[model samples]
Target: MRFPRSSGLLLHPTALPSPWGVGDLGPSAYQFVDFLAAAGQSLWQILPLGPTGYGDSPYQCFSAFAGNPGLISLDHLIQRGLLSYDEVVEASRRYDLNADQVHYGEVLAFKLPLLRHCYERLREGGAPDMAVAFTQFCRDQRAWLDDYALFMTLKEAHDGRSWHDWEAELRTRDPKALAEARTQYAEAFTLQQFFQFLFFQQWLPLKAYANEHQIRIIGDAPIFVAYDSADVWANPELFFLDAEGKPTVVAGVPPDYFSATGQLWGNPLYNWQRMAEDGYAWWIKRLRAAFTQMDILRLDHFRGFAAYWEVPAGEETAINGRWVKGPGAALFKRLEEEFGALPIIAEDLGLITPDVIALRDQFDLPGMKVLQFAFGGGSSNVYLPHHHVPNCVIYSGTHDNNTTVGWFEDLTEEEREVIRGYLGRSGSDIAWDFLRLAMMSVADMAVVPLQDVLRLDARARINTPGRLGGNWGWRFRDDVLNAGLAHGLHFFTEMYGRLPPQPEPDEPAEDATTEDELIYDPVDLATTA
Candidate 1:
């Protein structure tokens, strides 16, 4: 469905400022919501909120349905009498919490032990209400939660090896073996469930607070699940796996302009035939859960849904991959039947084909347009504001791109001249220039990264696609959300007709009676009719 005219910041919860080594669902999250509301934004876009695995990338998550435990607020736990302020402070002191960027290792070390402590305390006769709530949450989410919790427990039991690497019976998920494991690691399984409960307990309320302020959240969902995820382990038949549970073929892009050997994502390719047999039941469950956490979902790597690249499991690069037709309309048709009028945004950014366009148009899912890609071509460029359709989301720059300022600075003189000529400006404040372009564009939605809003440069770039380490760690300072900034952003919002409509006053003006004007009362009309 088409989105309303609105603007928001694309800052992940991890990017929010905090005293802890990493951002959490604490005071800063609420503060950011206030900032968005003050700026007249009706949307808040964030990256995937899943539990990151080896690379610490949200895209590579351990479970598609699970929340990131790292985002749970320890202060909230303290308020619940599960942890003490002194213990939190001590944990903070052990890490370099003052750093502007997240050190994932330090954050894990600082957070995990405390999280376990909270779980242990709660396990040993905690508050009655919380205990009841925990039981309810687990029961309500058992479709995926039980499998996920057990998967995590077993992973920890086996020194963090992937399920395929475990002993035969456990690797194959034999019923007897699973039962034995569950009995042996009962506490660990419950602890995993408790962590998930804390994550959603904090996140759901935060999402509701955004909705209360008329700010809808746009959350990212990767098209492919991680190879080592609970998604794969729990439902092996749905993927192209070998007898030993290893992927026979993986997901990636073929050679492209950017690289001779394309990006080998190494995610397992789904067995579309198998999934279709059950009418894509797994996808239905995944999306249903996603909607609970977010108002709108952005389907990442959307082209893959129409046709995806399939590379052999041991391939060094994506050069040898072949295009494999995907489930296309069948999967979406089922999803739409499950959840009517999907509030989805398609991440149709790379190498879009006719089938992908057809699939997107068929579902009426809004595509994305990035200002950073506008000047690379002439005025005919689709990314240019003039060429944008209203059924799309426009961004100054996405997480993958450098901040608008950094992008402008890195451009060649001719490229810079093209941008300056297009906008008719000196390009002194390029970030705002891009921001204004996005706001004034025909796209239904406009989203700018917080880095662009703050006019930070390359150092603040969220992620560089191919570079493995030191990504997704950028954080903003607490004091940056000033009143003046809100006022300025609000000006653009109002100027571009993106501000939400205000409610009419309860009392109207006491004016002289006008005979021609008739105000019909709903109650009178209903009774008369």
Candidate 2:
């Protein structure tokens, strides 16, 4: 989809500062929104907000349609009278909330119990209005919520084993066993729904606040669902599963410059023929749910939507995979019919084919460009700002890439010289230099990672693909954001015409001096006014 000429910062909510051992949809989130407004940012991009499983990767979530309970705010519950401030304070004492990195294991241990306590309070007839709202939320979201709540309750019963490892009756979803299990785990199931209710209860208001400040949110959605997810378990027939309910083929990428053996992502491949029988109903619902939380959705691995790499289930690496045709235009046609003019940004970064470019252009969706990739080759590199199209979204770096400074530090001296010569600078401030290149480019939108904005190095990188652990743990300190930082960023934003046009100034009184007039130079006044 075409976007406004604007810029934003890419920082997952997990990176926000809080005293709860993890960033959440609490006061700090609102403060971050305020920062975005002050910085003249028009977008707030985030990773997927789904509940993470074994690896704590947002992309591999428990449910495509559920919120991550780990992001719910207990302090918000205190305001609602479902939790007390003293209790929250006491709970905060058990974990290192001020740590620079997230301890996922400790966060889960600390959050789940308190979430359950809030659920119990609601069950005990506290907060009648919220109880009513919760009931309405469940009813409104029943199509997906019922299955997700049941799936989570069952996972807990089985000690966190994948559904494929469950008994035959439950694994295959035998009706009699399913009926009995629901009755026995009714409270647990309801509690899962309540957690979702609280997540959206806090999230929607935060999203609205960002919107009110003219800052649109861009949320991520993976092209493939995890094999162990509720979507796969609840609707096994939609995937290429064998008789025993295991995937026959999986998703991954073929060998490329990055890896000789290629990357094998063990996600279940979709049975496109089966899905088409119902007019791609599943994808429609998934996108519809995603739109409820975000203004624009970034489709991860956009090339996979045109043709995906399919490897037989037991393959050790992606070298043995073959390209298989996806649903392509038919799937997107159905989505557009449901929600017109798809507000999507395609993650068309790696190994893109003509067909993928065709698919993206057919929908007029914006693809991405990362400045970190530009200096690797000559002028023909599509990532270079000179070759950039006005329909793309530009970035200084992405979640998968190191901070711009770190990337520059690791480059060969010759490569560094090439970049410096191209930009006509000595590369003293690489992060802001990259940011300036991105903002001054013709791309419709530009987003810089918060780590790059903070001038952090590799130590603050958000994620590094293929690594098993220690990814998705970085968080920024609370003291880093200040008025000077906002003003500095706004200078670039305003100078590049990314900020929205300001209204004309009214006539000033004889002794009046407003904040804008007091702070800005006469040149700034002429430009802004």
Q: What are the per-residue Cα lDDT tens digits for candidate 2 across 170-265?
A: 899999998899999999999998888888777777887787778999999999999888999999999999999999999999999889999999
Counting clashing residue pairs in each candidate, in order, gives: 0, 1
Candidate 1 segments exceeding 4 Å error? 507-529
Q: What is the Cα root-mean-square deviation between model 1 and the actual structure?
A: 7.8
Q: On a 0 to 100 scale, what is the lDDT of residue 374 in model 2? A: 93
Per-residue error at 261 for model 2, in Å? 0.6
Q: What is candidate 1's TM-score against the reference?
A: 0.95
Q: Where is the poorest 10-residue window by lDDT in model 2?
A: 520-529
Query: Which lDDT tens digits does candidate 1 get at residues 146-188?
Result: 8999999999998888988899998899999999999999999
lDDT of each: 0.88, 0.88
The local lDDT score (0 to 100) that residue 366 gets in candidate 2 is: 96
